[model samples]
Target: MITATDFITIPYTSDLTQAGIAYACRSLPYTYDRMGGSHFNRLRRIVVGVAVELAFRRRLAEEKVPHDNLGSTPFTDPDRYDIAIGGRRCDIKSFMLTRRSLIRHVSREPQALLGADALVPSDQIVSDHLNDEDLYIFAFITALTTPNQRSLDRALKADQPIYLIHPLPKEWAHPSRWIPLGTLALKCDTSHAVTLELGGQNESRAFMAEEIVLEPRKRAAAESDFYALGYLHTSNPPDGIVGVHSPSVGETHLVEPIQWGNIWIYGMQIIFTGYMTRGEFRQRGNRLPAGSRVFKYSSTRTENRSLPIAELHPLSDLFTQAKKWAKRGA
Candidate 1:
């Protein structure tokens, strides 16, 4: 059983977030959601992934562990490997734990968060995913239960229990505070002019309701939590899995996306649950047919595989092993 102790939370700095967003933006033209989903959402995912890779690299250095930085961003340029340990290449896959999943885990006393799945999209599982990588590190990022900390503060101030967490992001049954421009076009009156801003850039611009069409821009003006990284300005595609919310009211609905990717680039935390190597994963991972529900985003894109968080080797074990490899190499 994986205890909470095995899960290490690394909070990132503004500089890291900025680097991640810049990398994501530059790579936006090259990389995309192979499954044919929201391109805006794809940018958010890439940002979160790079953040995790960068943070983990810093952690390895701080611990004095031997490793090689493989440049986690610019998506497909060199290869899929993010970093290497003991000459072993690693590819990191990120998954978002739904708000409902978080709440359920919180309520269960001493509950081992065992069932969280590290997702691998089906098509990428072949050409996109480099099978030669020595290991796979699956990390999970979370969203604030409420729209923002203020919402949580208001609930606590009123002496009320916070129970408004929904199961999936961008769900119609439980609408997220963050709505993307495309989704907003569908829901809100677009005739009125709306002002928008990029994540870190100063000054805002006005968009006619009609101009707020749903699509990914080379660059989007959004209100990002990191200030440096900025916000994810896109349509919040309604789905049963992970979602990004609209921007806030004071920020003119410039809600930072709480989805796995958006949060970190916009200054959110991610947890390192555990890891498994490619050979072992290929041997043990459960094969899910195309369109199987996996975590926040449904893997409707193609057939994919998944492994439970509980089944992964503890990060401590990985670190300990890395230390041994360093000694041998020395």
Candidate 2:
């Protein structure tokens, strides 16, 4: 249950329920003009999360497994959960769009709770409770979307929701090994607090939550960090590509290939022909022909290529280079 005023605050918490509620309160009734893009996205995520939880509860019940919705708890408190076929303490995460599973993202921040390493300097510690836990079962519910925001906007307005659900990131490194599930539950010991583990490879060390604080060091200076957008040869691939385009009538189309479309960059496969949407082509006015709204161009994968500029063959190399430079805000 999200309140109206919650929209004003951008809540960033590791907790699933809180984040979902905050996102929904801030982002629903999404209109292109109303603004609050982050909030809208958050709402979508939260909705998906709820669906996952319900489904998990139902399945576990059928199997006579015991489980609780930790997400349904209060904002300030950390909800403890357990998954069981017969009231056992099994750890699991629920997903709505695809298969049943969870993917937990762990990175060291300045300070946080529940990490083996101290979250240095800062007063708070943000540890991923579910960092490495075995589960009774895991699942995912993937909600797919139209390539660009505009199409998605139209679809949402029409009240048609779309999403894709699957097991792993197709074709990339360790496909099965890379599960894109959200954090569902962390298995804890006697007390409600999460247990912290430590180990480089084989052996293991352990730490209590109260014993440590972890912090992050400032990033080392670098000359430049170049972001290169990669594209597959074909229009429709298992992992779709996302490009930025403006839909205004006179605006030029600045169709830029995304490095990783829709966040999942690993092992996305695309065929030989490049895919360009009608709205996207319209945005790059001069570059794309007026009547010829959609453009599909493909390029051969070269041995040592710089960027995916070859795909935009019609345009002059200089123009393409200029577009790339402009994108970098240079």
Candidate 3:
């Protein structure tokens, strides 16, 4: 769904190695270890950012455009701006595209005041780097999804035909378009930061910002090949496990015990649930079932060592009822 207009294509010219990329990832504000990727997502971002800067520098040199690569000096502070052109400091913000749109964490703090109903902009929303920079340049890069496809991976592997890069519209420079940093509602955890709604009902279909499709390597696969039964400890199920739509199956599958570990008895029935890989769970938009707190068994521990079958309730009974209803409708 990506189009040529969405990017500002640049040729690969940097000699930056993967080790350098990994080092930069660690140096950045959100360190690589905390970035929640099973592998490589953060590294890709760092590489792409450096590539864009290098490419921009090359283009400027060829055209005799005046600019200072602040990053070039031996004494250049890591805190200094990326580049200075025509006396204006420009900082490059790079993001990876998924489902044809970019989803980035814009602020460390909420955009508005916490615990307040009004949407007034917060003074703390501005960072020291943002305040010092005269202009912000955003670069969007595409991650390779298939084995034979052309992508940023090609550039990383030193293959021909590197990944495509694009610059967002000039309007993004405006502060209003920036993703808000604050909570969507009061009392929610700070980790639940706000995001910008890029498209609405009337927008063109091709430009909509859909759910991010994380690459296989970037996600953790299911622990075991087979599914098992688990028990739901609480009567209330989590929002994602309870009502969210699953695009893969075309219909929401009732929360079934996919993997079993610990057993809990509620009334006369044993409530069972199973382990879902972080990848599969993220497909449900990263929601966890409500009673996740009560079920603390590790996903890596596949065998149910202690529980007896006599005390465990069968999940097949619920699945059988669902199948019977489907046949009657048919």
Candidate 4:
């Protein structure tokens, strides 16, 4: 039984959010044309997802935990294994609390959220796209207020190098094409989204994906709905880092880390619920068939394998385990 103490809270700041938006732009060119969603929605998810991954990395840094840099060369998507802790690869899964969920339990300063029923999406767990990392870290973003939008107007440039969109480079057998995200003109035919032409002369080898990717009016997220949380860079109460302890379900400070970055969450709180090892996931993940219910939806768009958020091991526990190895070397 997972308790509140199992959850770890990390501050998501403006700098990281902007960086995530920029990253979404930088990666749009090399992004995979996914199934069942518009290219724009995919972009928006990238914006928020990247922000979550960035926030986690920042927290690890402030805590002075040694880890490998997540940056991958252009054309190679290095984000799969979001981070490495004590040599263990970690894949991050994130979700934003719905307004209803927040209204029911969250307030200006509510107890640590218990998104116990939260889950990993179907597409992520299906046979082809299943993750192979050592750990799967899940986190939740507060829906306290509406998050403002950030557009990808000039984020992607013809010459800008792309990184972290797909795991492999163009040289690999399976290639994720680079396209002007919002510029595509598409039409659906027989359940396929075919690209007619692009708005810009991106020189992306005149590449177009046959997959049905609805063009998003906005390339990136307009905003991640949320409210502000106070942040400070000191060994004080306003200490930027906070944790939601278990059993008590109380929010409190974790440590006065050696954080040098702004580590701003602008106005949102990010809490890491827990993580499951690859083996544990394989052992306990419930197989979600395609068209089966995932969240509240009557059916999911794709097949998947998922686990309950409530059954995960604590983020604090991972930190504790990392410390043991950290003391030995890296």
Candidate 5:
């Protein structure tokens, strides 16, 4: 049985370095195109995979457990697994828990077929590539809902737990191609038939009558205190200052600015940063000098405060410093 001892925790830190940020800004446009246009949500999903993989690998290394990382292997390869431990192939499946009690299905396909016997057996849909000898590890992580930069920074620094389940038998594994029971019974168009190749024969099937009722099962698990891993920050400091802002009070407050890159760090944990058009800045609130640009420090929060002219750095200087830092890191 999988126990608490089997799990490992990996810390999360801001990986944004001067060079990394510079590279990201330069290449993100091309990368987004190559990833199929501006699908930020899709890109975020891929990043979660990367984070989980890295955390697992780090834990293995720390425990002195010998394992081979096979993530670079092509997905089409039958032997592809996330890691190999003691010659046992282990595949990692990760999902995000949006709420305290639920996890939505990852599969986008319909779950049931159209007929008197509409429930599709789970075994038929399981991938043939997964060998019987291979073990499955499911990693369920928490999702953050920070609305502002302050909250985001705090969430990133805070220790979040990851629940893991292991050795899930291949026989119990379900296919990602499953449709909702309600959709299958009521909304499915009878005229549109689905073709399936089964047992060396091509079969075309049409939707059943609306009177058919198939109950949908809740795939998510209840809350449990499983083994969890915590994310910690690395030794390296932040790449650059994003911006600077102070809390709004009746009395004027002195602002202290620390420059990192194009952004400024101030008030200890808060980062001052954001871009706005000259017209928008003037029309919305206070205006700076005619040639000067204005950047909102607390853009993510409801309370707004403007940086004093003396505390503000020229945009040109920030870019130059960022370039220098990038080269130094390189």
Candidate 6:
């Protein structure tokens, strides 16, 4: 049966299809052709990495070959260390659209080819040298460089060095182009630690040391929408603290990491005033003394002692639908 799950193998050809597939793969908002340059490129790599990791996770659950996310490691840097997986040290490099151009432009440098070949070996070349258990690989993600016609045309025509290798070394007949399927085939090595080093004429660290890790810890799905509020807090909470569920579109949903000094809400009405858990909402805090309803939405309070139940049915339905959409998106 060609179930919805089978759609996983489909190759996206149109902008809408691509966006739809990507959104379904992960719910992060995407702007067509707008997000570019270095930041966007890096983001694209991360998203692609996450999506690929997810797909592998699913496959493994179904008893397919095992794999995991290769957290915070850039595969190309030599001195940057990662934990040895299966007794072999493996590095992770995220290859995006501009990556080809960068390598192509730089390959003309003396001994550039040698360094490139040794550091970022081509898939076919790696296949020849690597037995089933004896290879370090690059996890490449082929994100659409440009969604619009102008950008697409520019990228396609751009003479970037897409080919890191010359004519297949006779031993291996096929070359692994940066394509969608190639992204799926490669899995991040989870047992490896990641290190990113940035030192050149620019002379600045690109990825913060804290950002790289082998497992690529993710914000839980429940907390994905609420994590943004953490920054607004006066004092940041400790990391790894589970968030509290707050009223959202409907039912209570997980809030991201909380900051101290904020009012707690029970459906738009400030029911309580206190510090949101010391580090996490899961942390307990004292609730404010109940007072007469202050403002009126559906019910008005005659005296300062009476309170009214807030309308929650409509909001609950909305929250339910939001969760459904999230599930379908995956």
TM-score of 3: 0.31
Candidate 2 residue spans exceeding 4 A from truth: 1-37, 66-71, 76-91, 94-136, 146-148, 156-330
* Model 6 whole-model lDDT (C-alpha atoms): 0.24
- Residue 161 of model 3 has an lDDT of 33
* lDDT of every model, 2 decimals: 0.52, 0.24, 0.28, 0.47, 0.28, 0.24
Q: Pick the candidate with the highest lDDT.
A: 1
Residues 91-116, model 3: lDDT tens digits = 55443333222112111211111111
What is the Cα root-mean-square deviation between model 1 and the actual structure?
A: 11.7
Error of 3 at 20 (Å): 5.3
Model 1, which residues run further than 4 Å from truth? 71-79, 98-112, 124-133, 144-267, 298-300
Best candidate (score: TM-score): 1
| CA displacement after TM-score superposition, residue 27 of candidate 3 (Å) | 3.6
Q: Across residues 1-330, which tens digit of lDDT does each residue of candidate 1 receive?
A: 476668877764666655665566444434545556554456556666677777888888888888887654443253446688888887877764546665356335213456656666555556645554477887776534234456545545756432221111223111233333322211222333223222221122211111233233222332223111233333232122222333332222322223312222334456787888776777777887877775555545667778777888888888889999989988
Question: Distance (Å) between predicted and true CA of 74, model 2?
Answer: 1.6
Tens digit of lDDT per residue, candidate 6, span 105-130? 42233122212211121222223322
> Residue 263 deviation, candidate 1, in Å?
8.5
When sorted by TM-score, best at the front, the candidate numbers are: 1, 4, 3, 5, 2, 6
Candidate 1 vs 6: which has more TM-score = 1
Higher-TM-score candidate among 2 and 6? 2
Worst 10 residues of 1 by lDDT: 201-210
Q: Count the backbone clashes (under 3 Å) in each candidate.
A: 23, 52, 15, 21, 22, 6
- For residues 1-330, what per-residue lDDT tens digits would candidate 4 score against the true structure? 467766677655666556664555445545665435643445455666778888888788887767776554343253455477776677777766545655356444333444344455445554443345467787777632212211111222222221211111222212233322222222222122212111111333322222223222212111111111111112111212222111111222232222211212223667788888765677677777667754434565655567666777877777877888878983
